[model samples]
Target: MRRPDVLVVGAGGSGAALAARLSEDPGRTVLVLEAGPVPRFPPGFPAELRDARLVPGAWPDAPTVRAYPVRLTPDLPYTAVRGRVLGGSTTVNGGYFIRARREDFDRWSARAGDARWAYERVLPFLRVLETDLDFGATPVHGGHGPVPVGRTGLGHPAVEAFRAAARELGHPDEPDKNAQGVPGVGPVPTNSAGGERINTGTAYLLGALGRPNLTVLGDCSVRSVAVERGRATGVVADRNGRRTVLEAGEIVLCAGSFASPHLLHLSGIGPAKVLTRAGVPVVEDLPAVGAALSDHPQVVLEWTPRRPVAEPAGSWLGGALHLSSSGGDHPGDLEILQSLVPMAGLVGRRTAVPGRPLALLASVQTPRTSGRLRTVSADPRVPPRIDYGYLETADDRRRLREAVRAAAALLSTSAFGEVSAGVVEPASLDDDGLLDRWIRSRLGTSQHTCGTVPMGRAGDPSAAVDGHGRVYGVSGLRVADTSILPAAPLRGPAATAVLIGELIAHAMCTVR
Candidate 1:
């Protein structure tokens, strides 16, 4: 085997896209190492991964799901379902592929001090990643690309009721949910086609499979980045219990949000205290490696159906409505997503609802409260401690209160009344104290985690990576994944993760 020009860590959504895009130039050999199993071709994937609708831990549980135990509020212990396969979470995600809004990029650009982070500048890259089946002709959408995107599960009666109720509440219909769409009700643009989950490993890496310049190795977990002096030389990895040293000209960490920071902590590139506690030699005391944790905190509002509805045949999610919590303060700050069918067995029996519950997941998009991701042990096999400080601030609780209030109003509408009998338990939005407590009790993740390794300029003590996705205090190394995002975008991070990989690859190619 030849030494690769670029060694991408973790063949998830970002890593797969970066590796495949880098290999476009046959001269530069690209290699990707994924902790989970990855197949060379689409057919090599399992049947569970083929369906775009079935989330691994959702109702009628499917295989190939890995759950990491984390604390939602220190009091609330939750297990986050993550995809351990080649495509990362994309292979198992519900396929919500909505792009981050312009406001989101404005924050990114300002934080990173780079014009390339501007929404307009990054728009072209997003267009090149997906072939939108619904809105391809649109100027903002891509007509020919690797990933296939379209709308599904909208035909359900519950989905229709949710849309009608939102319209009744005066929320206008914004059909296009991509970059061009406004904050309103519409079908969610998903990266699913023909009932199959067309994830990055299958979409972006499909062509690079047999290419001479690219090699994707799965079941190979990188324990740490081998940083010699100030440059990243390679990685210390274990492939099925056998440890080995792999060298590359440049290294890229694309291990998503949770694992990427964990890798950095293990590599002794984080806070000195963490390194000392883990008993690892501190290489660089970058205190920002696992700081500023941001996630979309979600609270679900359920309604028992007036007339019983069957289990949904397609995707659980169909339509979503975006709103501003504080008018004009934050655009698209509140996302009221509809789960058309109840996740009866999503979490053992805890998710079981009465009368086929129709759920509306109210997620606080722009949360003011941030948390921390810390290392508790040196062993890479042991997961890190995640302290999600959700609803810790009065402002965050206020935003979530508004979302719950909005969702409750939608469920009470006549359109919803036709389908819903009444709101179930925790409909206590009448009192501010009760509503605040409700927000705390139900606080959960939208599965969109970011901001651990924030993108900022040099001398910013709170930053871990730079605008060009390069890690500070390290040479010939970069991180192109969700962890490098300045904050969690208003939309799901699925599309944004792919966009990050594409944008980072373009930047690297330009530099080369």
Candidate 2:
């Protein structure tokens, strides 16, 4: 893996795809470095990591996940956990592989000042990333792709009730959540198969393993990107407790929302004032690096079921309702996701709830609030201070408040009555003041972090990277991850991250 033609940092969701696609050519050499080590294939990983129903990352002692202290609000302290192992968050998530709404790419295209990012322009790449089990070989979805996309394979009584409740409440039925169809209740597209989370590592990397030109090394921590002469040529890493400087013709970072931007800061490719304050020589004074943090600020509503909600052996996230907020310009901006099983064990600590619980996750999909990330200290080990300015705008607060109330209504319907249970927390969301306080106190994140390195045209001072993810002030370096997203997608980012890898990989190949 020495002097690989292409070096991908962080073998998570996007990194796995980037390495897999770039290494397709036998002539191109690729090396992927991951900090967290786990079995690349089945039987090697622990049981909790294998199944999405387990919600492995929430466990206090889980090794594959890194829990970082982040502020969701002024006084609300939260833990923003990011997957550290191969396949990234996909390994630890609930297998909600829903695609980014078409509107998401519209803003991306607008910010980049390029039409190539438009939904129509990017649909083919989207098709290339997934094999849609529900609708295959269609004009909109792919049939033969590396990643397998299926919908609500598990049967849960509550999921059925949730769907029925949506219909009873006059919401349309959206069978395929991945489609460009209208917002409504629908099955959550999952990337799992045979009860195993088929993460990007399994879908893209595993298939291309053993290739002479490809090497994947886990437990290798990249201390900094080696940017010499204002160009990224390689990375200085700690491999097996030894300092190693590995060079590459091109370096791509797919370390996700937080880690990717964090790496750029460590490499001295960030705001001049911040890096100088940290005592690190500036490689590039990119003001936008880690400046515009966008994400979904979500709150959980977990309740105890009438009886012990019989557990099911399937994907935990089975159904969801996407609806527009009152007076909102966007569609499906307010979300209420239904979990097939009790979620008290998963995120109950955030809500101060404990016991077998049925849950509804609500959030404002299009938050106007933008947060910031700053490298407080030069030490690479010292994590950046992430100030997730959640619900800063009155509009965001209103939309999220509506979504939470909608979730309560859904739970009150006869559909939920079948499994009728008592409320777990916030005894009442009766008044606006009380609800707002509850929201701030229990606020959390979907972990769909984006826009740290905003994508825009050259003249735009806020722009850090170009539309193709090339760093503005550096050469031989590119980023293909959720961090490049101008904002969080309406649904989730798992599939979008894969699409980004395929899109950027193709662009890199074309340029070569």
Candidate 3:
């Protein structure tokens, strides 16, 4: 493929959505290059990927998955799992599809100097990407769109107790958690419409395959954006050991937070010193391309429910609770999630505490600590080094410690009296020091990675991309994924990633 109107690298959530939206304009041709295989049939996407009960795609050793090594601490190394299939990490994720908080957009707007990124401006783009089945025709939700989002719908006894417990603690029950900035306990809105997961490939790419102007080339790894004279012309991709220069009028990097910056560095578009050390020639010395990596830090706690769970085999996550740490009127900075399934086997090689049948996860929504992504080599096949730098800051440790304490309190509420027997971990939450030690040992990723190639005001030296996903010091090259996020949103980044795809497509189309 040569000289297409637009070339999109990595057909993950953002790339697939951008390609589909761009193809709607019949005058322009779009090509999406993906590192994973095309999930041609329903069976092509593995049963584990379809099952919401298990995070099979999260297994680093899984044959179908690609896991990156992340150094959470200097002594501890954890695997950051990303799906290597058509829909990217969406294929392997738990399918929690909630929008970013309004403050997230407001923050982006203040930094990027682009009001288009503000909550009111970006909400329309979010609406264009989803067909909300549960909350139809709301002021903040879309009634009809490609991706179908609805409540988990599965009713479990323990989940009901959890919600009631939240209400007892003064957090009201929100009918739709995705609605206009509601901080309360409610059923998790999932991307799964029926039983199967609704990923980007299923929602955006599959139905649009018949479009003549759109082409999806899967099982292809994009080496780098082919740049000449400070402008991107195309990408160098390798498919089955065959290297090809797929040229385009405009190149969009949607390889995600980890891969997007890696691709940029490989193409000589990152910090000059790092590129030189990696034996790559420098094209543009942008200091922040692979910097400022951020993800939600979470600690999982298991409990022993005294009564039998109604449906243990059903959906794992029954509901979620969003609360503020400062007790102010802003969106929640802490999230406590309930999972009906046992998650002892999920974390790699952890001793399982017996008698714990239920899982409760607490995540710090706005993490103060950030990390970096660096290249081991110039080779695209070589996975980059990921250091999440979790809980490095005094603020992060303090907030996360408080979050753990909050989760423990929520479990001990009167509502859990009918369901839970007692806390299964730490032996006792009575000692603050013991609970803090337990939290640090068990902290894990919420799988919401963002802010590597962050978007900022054009003049800001730390900004990799300008307000509208265009990389600094490079033309015709833009990043349209979670990697472009300036910070981790209050909720999961998937829905916000989709909104970004829509917004960027609109920008690219009008620019053309």
Candidate 4:
């Protein structure tokens, strides 16, 4: 096959968006290679797979004990979950949309020396990618965007109760969380259209599949990037045991945070010692490719409601409380999410005649604990070692405990008092250590991994890529995905990943 103008690796949220954008010009040849099969949504998904009570290890696509087993460090017991399908983790994530906070971007600009990444500049790209269902009159959101963003129509009973309690607790209800830029309790804006998941594969790749210039190949695992004279020429991929070398003028790595850096290392682009130990030639001595990883650590507070609140038996509620950590002084630095499901004990048994089974989940969004991702072996088939390092700091534990107290206070309110029975996770209200024990046992990844290949100024050794996402020592290769985030945001990473793809496509177009 001939060389394409651009080769996009990993047809996840970022790659799909980039492929669709490049196909619009009808001039450039774009090739997208994905390691997993086509995305499958609900209704077609198995009933067992849809059960929320099952642990992360039981989920078919979960990375825990399935395809990509996470190697948890002693400090943290949580497993990291990431999807391997064409749409990537977005296919399985709860479709919540949260724009990057201005404060968060300000920190990134100062730390990374990229003033263009300030929230003001990136907001336009975010708006361009979304078609807000509630508020489109504002200039920040576009009405004709390919991806549809809207509110939830059928909310779980626990969600409604949680919202009422939040309002009673002096929190104002936000009509549109995506609009007005105010943090409060209300329905989360989702990336769904008509109650169906609108993952990147459905919204972007499939839409552009008809174009002749764009070719999408699924079930093709990339072995390593092909580099020559510090320039990426193509990739060495294995399609079900068949090896082939595909060439490209420019290469873009959109394989989530972990895979992208690991793939680069396999291609001899990471730390010198790591490649040497793995018996791979050193193409570039980039020491920061897999360092400085960060993720949100969640401590779940579970409880059972008193009354049967019309809760759906087999559905999941994506409701959450967006609050500032400030007791009352400033906007919150943390987020509290609510999940309504049954307990593992009640999975197979039916609820009693008088009392129905239900569980309430409350979690902290922005965690202080930091983690790292490293290559376990040079073999591309082996998953990388993931050290979540959850609750490794006093701040993380303190904030989580505070979040639990806040959630318990909300449940005690009149709105929730009418429905909730008692706490289920801690099992005892007097035990102060119960929350800590529960968190260590049930904590898991929210599937929003990032910051493995961070972007910053040239002098920063930890910064693997430049502000424009170009690798430090490699030419004709760039990374335009969540891996480029200097710091993980407090909300969903999907919207930001798509925005990165759009920004990179625009940059590539202007550069040529």
Mark the 10 consecutive residues where model 1 has the least summed lDDT: 345-354
lDDT of 4 by residue, 393-474 (tens): 6666666666666777777788877667756555544455776676667665556677889888897888899877899999
lDDT accuracy of residue 462 in candidate 4: 81
lDDT of every model, 2 decimals: 0.83, 0.83, 0.82, 0.71
Candidate 4 residue runs with Cα over 4 Å from true position: 39-58, 61-66, 71-78, 154-157, 311-315, 326-330, 343-357, 367-369, 427-434
Model 2 misses residue 179 by how many Å?
Answer: 0.8
Off by over 4 Å in 3: 312-314, 327-330, 345-356, 367-369
Model 1 lDDT per residue over 1-512, tens place: 77889999988789889999999999999989987887877888877677655565442234455677788886888777777778888987777898888888888899999999999999889889989998674678889989988876566787888889999999988888785566999888888887777888989887778898899898888999999998999999999779999999999999888889989889888999988998878888999988778888898887888886766555657689998887668777899988755755344323224555667889989834387899888898888888778777778778889989998998889998887898885757789998887777777788888999989989999899998889888898899999898788878889999999999999999975
Off by over 4 Å in 1: 57-63, 310-313, 345-354, 367-369
TM-score head-to-head 3 vs 4, winner: 3
Better of 2 and 4 by lDDT: 2
Q: Which stretches of candidate 2 lie over 4 Å from their true place?
A: 153-155, 347-355, 367-369
Best by TM-score: 2
TM-score of each model, in listed order: 0.95, 0.96, 0.95, 0.89
lDDT of candidate 3 at residue 495, scale 0 to 100: 88
Error of 1 at 457 (Å): 1.0
Candidate 4 residue-wise lDDT at 350: 26
